[model samples]
Target chain A: MKIVIVEYGMGNIRSIVSTLQYLGVQDVVLSSDFEILNSADKIILPGVGSFGKAITQIRHRNIDNYLNEIVLENKKPILGICLGMQLLGNSSTEDGNNKGLGYINGYVVKFDNSLVKVPHVGFNQVKVNNKLKLYNGFNDIPTDFYFTHSFRMKSDVEINQCYCNYQEDFVASFERDNIAGVQFHPELSQTNGLKLLKNFIDKF
Target chain B: MLRKRIIFSLIYSDGYFMQSRNFRLQKVGNLNWLEKNYRFQSIAFALDELIVLNASKTEKNITEFAKTVSDLVNDVFIPIAAGGGIRTLEDAELLFNSGADKIVLNSLLFQDPNMVMKIIENYGSQSVVASVDCKLNLGSYEIFINNGTKKLDYDIQKYLIYLEELGVGEIYLNSIDRDGTGFGYDFDLIKIVEDITKLPLIIAGGAGNENHLAKGLQINKVSAVATANLFNFIGNSIPNARDYLLDNGLNLSNRVFDTLDLI
Candidate 1:
């Protein structure tokens, strides 16, 4: 399958590409070109920085416009990881109030450092809603995934969601039609992560 | 629940990966030797995270070290944090672009606090790990930087507080005296400063076996246990240690998936 990782100069694109290649994807492309992005069988949005800065880069590079056409209108499958997943939400409080793609009805807020540590680094168990296409073959269990972020997403829409408790339970992964996102780094989470990525490639 | 981590750190100096003891380097093998013996594709399953540090001494070449990092991370499917001689933003960019999920900073924490702040500002705090090398001196933990050669004026506890103020995501506290000794982690040093900061602590230096790792993880403040003892954990040692940790309930990632089945 032709996989395109949308790159706007903000995240760990190399590891994402390496993971894709390891998964036997022969035609994985890291490009934000209008035609290339629209024509891909699957698209991954990987990121690892400030959400405000990332959205600015995306808008400046006109990627926000391209994603609207390809992801919103055309209905192509797109999986957003970490900051990429945060960008698919309505808004985020990272750095300052900034707009997201608004594909999912959610908003991002920082974890209370008083309750739990900031950045929330290391491996954490994700309570998987197995009914979602992203967790297709996985059993109904809270599997582990790597998470390292300060801000988290919450939505009242009740989409197929996965939850992880750090300071308290927060959004881990969510799916809405063609749009899916994980607050964890599937590329770095080892086996469980690789399995989740495989499910994205096969089921989503 | 947020689980503890088992981090396997690789020390690369010049052209070969080195065996580090008391901050002294000894050439062990090259990338080929590592691939043949460790086989990251297989052994990677045994680690929660991998830290690759560029410990070159004579006029460090950042580009060559980053190339090694990229090549090393190809088959390794875990969070890789690479550093050592990360002086500027360009150097960090090269490492991150070459497949490093986080940048480990040592000397910069002392010499260039601004640089650390800049990296955290640009990449966010989650992408920066502050590596503080400490040595026990007369019942006091003295902090050392610049590849563990130069001793800093700041005390280890005070330096940790400074690092926390800089907004680093985690602290990789390595004991220089216990390094490569295979005795165990400096429990006294860790006990003194373990509660100084709230950031996730990764205890490194003298983990010789699974029991040593378990002892490090048993400390509630220590978020992970890191080891670079090549002599101890080379072949089946990693998988074996992982089994020991699991059987004893170390809170490591217990999820099992066929490495080949992902494809």
Candidate 2:
């Protein structure tokens, strides 16, 4: 299968590509070209850095157009990791109010620094919704995944959401049919992450 | 619940990985030898994070070290923090582009606070890890920088507060006295500074075995435990240690997926 990882001068594209290759995926391409994304069997919207800057870069490359066509119109399965996941939400309050792809029904906000440490780093337990294809093998258990971000997403709608609690529970991952997003780096989460990525490839 | 982490650190000097003992470098082997012996691709399963530091006492080359980091991280799925001689923003950018999820800073935090702030501004606070080397002297912890060679005028408590003010995400506090001794972590040093800052603390320097790792993790304030003693925990030692920690009901991530199933 041809897996295209959207690259816009942000995120850990190298780690995602290397992880995909390790999972025996051969035709992995890191490009923001419309044709490359459109031709992909699956699309991974990997991202890091600020939300405002990320949105600007995505628009500059016209990746928002590519994603809309390939993922929304053509119905290709897509997985967004970390900040990539946040970009799939309705909007984020980071770096001024910035709009997202609105692929999922969620809003991103900064973690209450008064309540806990900002930029919650390291491995944290995520309560998985195994009913979703994104968390197939987890068996509805709490699993650890690497998280390093200040802003988190929350949704009122039931989009098959998984929750992780730092001080308060927030959306850890969600899957609405073919579209999926995880607020952790599956590429950097060891076997469990690899398993999740494999599910994204096969089950989705 | 946020789980504690078990991290493995690899000290690189020149072209070889060194066995560091009390801040002294002893060349062990090259990257090929490391892969042949440790097989980090597989060993990574046992670790929560991996830190590769360029401790080259001579002139440090960011490009060459970054290349080694890139090579070492292939197929190893975990957060890799690489840094040693990051003097410029481009130097920090090179390592991050190479595959580093976070950049470790030591001397830069002191020598160039403005440069450190610039890096944090560029990469966000979460992307920077401030590594502080400390040695106990006259009933107080003394701060050391530049690969533990130079001493700083700042006290340990004030230095930690300074790091927090610098907006680093985590603190990698390494004890120079117990560096590679394999005895255990310096609880005396850890106790004094664990609650000083709200940032996650990763205690390093003197972990010999699984017991040492467990002891370090038992501390409620410590977020992670790191050991660079290559000779002590070789082969399947790390994997066994993880299992041991899990079996003993430690609050570590118990999720295990067989990646071999993918192949």
Candidate 3:
């Protein structure tokens, strides 16, 4: 059960390693090596360009203090998608105010063009906030995936599990326990985004 | 509560799949016949992001056919809107990390109207969608760009009131002389952008039948209505247009077109 995605150079890493080898997930590892992303068990990261060049390439490969000491002082299980879920929050206004990976509290704003339309891309519908397990077997409230961002996560955080509405209501999936975040693109989401990447690889 | 939205548009060229109203050109299969039959029957679907416009290929084969249709519709559950030739903000962040949930921007909003406030400051104006390929000219209905080829003197109701002060959640007004010519929509230019913007408007080209999507949903200020040759050359689908809009009584949005059989 070794996962480790976090490539750095900024997104589309061979389509998230061909969507984790089309969900068969043969011990996936793209690595930017922070000791193999702190000896992985499961830590996916997947980002896609600018947010100050992916937080200056994760503080120029200090790997953001070994991903805040393996997902906030050794909790383990991590998954961040879409600019790696806006760099796991706590700071980001986009081109000016930086600092994120605060491990999830909230701070990424920039897509409220008054009502909607700004990198919100396509295929959206998600509501699930019922105590997440990476939406185990999906569907609790809205559940239609695949999203492109422009900065979200505001709705007064607190690990928002899911919430999507285009011109307003933001945060579309966020967890704190083992650190999870999904603004959408569960490896380009297809069969419930490959059953949410095989339920984050059957929770490792 | 208001959630019913279905759209299915796949008109690519050169790299394949382009047969909407006899343009003829099909190849790219395994669309899994749209997920083994319209993936829970369309509440929202679209991929007509215009095959990299004016095609002829190469931007590395249109980013390898947009990453093979974003990895074959990344487990499609519903809502999918990808629009043609998106301009920048890194081509909408590589089609939102290649799985797109919504990104329809037309000719880069008339070639950079501040790239729609820089894609609502990087993906937020409801994931940015503002496509207007209108026509009418003299009597006043302008806003055309690229695909409809040039024309913009502005005033398509003052550029949808400047795309409703640049926060545009959704507006896909299309109608280029009744696109593909089925001749239905343009309900007076969708009642002039639904009498000046409330937002959520998706009226593409001329619809054809189903009473022109039941007169654009009996003008309750159209929230969604799209037709590419009335469901790809009159096959109809989306449960036959939601059973002809609930047998003409109207009032849709019952999530995913409300469990269909329509026969």
Candidate 4:
């Protein structure tokens, strides 16, 4: 199966490709082109950096439109990682009230600096949503995944959401049918991350 | 629960990984030798993060260093922070493109605050890690830049406050005195600097054994503990250290992935 990592000039695309290759994935392409995205068996929207800048770049490349066609219209499975996951939400408070892609029913907000340290870095325990295809192997146990971000997504909707706690519980990952998003970097989360990616590839 | 991290740092000079002692570097081995001796890929599973610093004192060529970074992080599924000679935005971008999840800055944080700001602006503060090398001289901590060669006038407290104000995601505090000594981390220094900033603090240098690591982690303020001493923790040493940490009931990740054949 061919998997395309949607690259709109953001994130560590090399690691994603290398991890997929390590998992014995034959065809893993990193491209933002519409045709390339459309031709994939699965698509990964990997992102890092600011939400405002990412949204601006996505709009500039008409990637939002392309994703609307490829993912929304075609019902193709898509997994968004870190900032990529936040962009799938409705809006964000980061960089002065930025709007997201509006795919998932959630909004992003920065962690209260008064409470916990900002930019929650390092490995954190994620309560895996075992009901979904994103986490297929583990039996409802909290797994460790690498997370690095200031802003986090919070949703009131039932999206098969998995929660992780820094100070309070927040969305770690969510899976709804073919659409999935994780606040952590599966590509960077060691063996646990590799397992999650494999689940996305094989099950989704 | 957010677990404390066990980070393994690789000190690279020219094309070889070095064993550093009190800011002086001794050439240990090249990439092949590292893989053959340590088998870093397998050992990386026990690590939360990997930091590769290019300490090429002669000429810090970012392109060549980035290639080495790329080679090291091929299948290692952990957050890799690479730096040393990242002067411009293009240099930071090159390292990120080469598979660095985060970029470490040392001299640039002091030399050019504007360049540091630019990198922070583009990649966000979380993508940038401020590495401060400190040495306790005459009972006062002095900060160092330029690969620990030049000492700054301001003390570590002032420098740390400055870094926090500058909006860096994390602080990699390496004690030059304890570096590669196999003695232990400077807990007194950590006590002084722990309350200065709200950013995640990664304490580096020293740490010869699992007990040292455990002691470092026992301190509530430390976010991560790093050890760069190659000889101390070689072969199955890291994996063994991790198991020891876990068995001792330390708050580290213990998720077993025996289903590698699931895919």
Using lDDT as the measure, which candidate wins?
2
lDDT string for model 1 (B22-95, tens) is 98999999989988978766887888999998898888899999999898778787899999999999999999
Error of 2 at B55 (Å): 0.4
Question: Each prediction's TM-score against the native?
Answer: 0.99, 0.98, 0.34, 0.98
The whole-model lDDT of each prediction reads 0.90, 0.91, 0.64, 0.90
Query: Candidate 1, clashing residue pairs?
Result: none
Residue-wise lDDT of candidate 2 within A86-195, one digit each (tens)? 99999999899999999999999999998988888877888887877987867677888988899999999998899999999999999988899999999888888889
Better of 2 and 4 by lDDT: 2
Ten consecutive residues with minimal summed lDDT in candidate 2 chain B? Answer: B254-263
Per-residue lDDT over B1-263 for candidate 3, one digit per residue giving the tens place of the 0 to 100 score: 23334454555544544434322234443345544444522322222121122122234244655664575444433444565676677777777667564577777776787976886665556666688878886787877776665787878778888886877677878787777567788788888888887676778776776677677766775656777652443333555666667666565532321112111
**Model 2: DockQ score:** 0.79
Candidate 4 stretches greater than 4 Å from native: none
**What is the TM-score (0 to 1) of chain A in model 4?**
0.98
First chain TM-score, candidate 1: 0.98
Per-residue accuracy of model 2 over B19-73 as CA lDDT, tens digit each: 9999999999999998899987788888989999999988998789999999977
Decide which is better by TM-score, 2 or 3. Answer: 2
Name model 3 segments beyond 4 Å from true: A1-76, A81-84, A87-91, A95-98, A103-147, A151-184, A199-203, B1-76, B80-123, B126-128, B131-154, B157-161, B169-171, B176-203, B207-263
Summarize candidate 4's per-residue lDDT along B50-76 as a digit string, tens digits.
Answer: 999999898788898999999977948
In model 4, state the lDDT of residue A200. Answer: 90
Name model 1 segments beyond 4 Å from true: none
Best by DockQ: 1
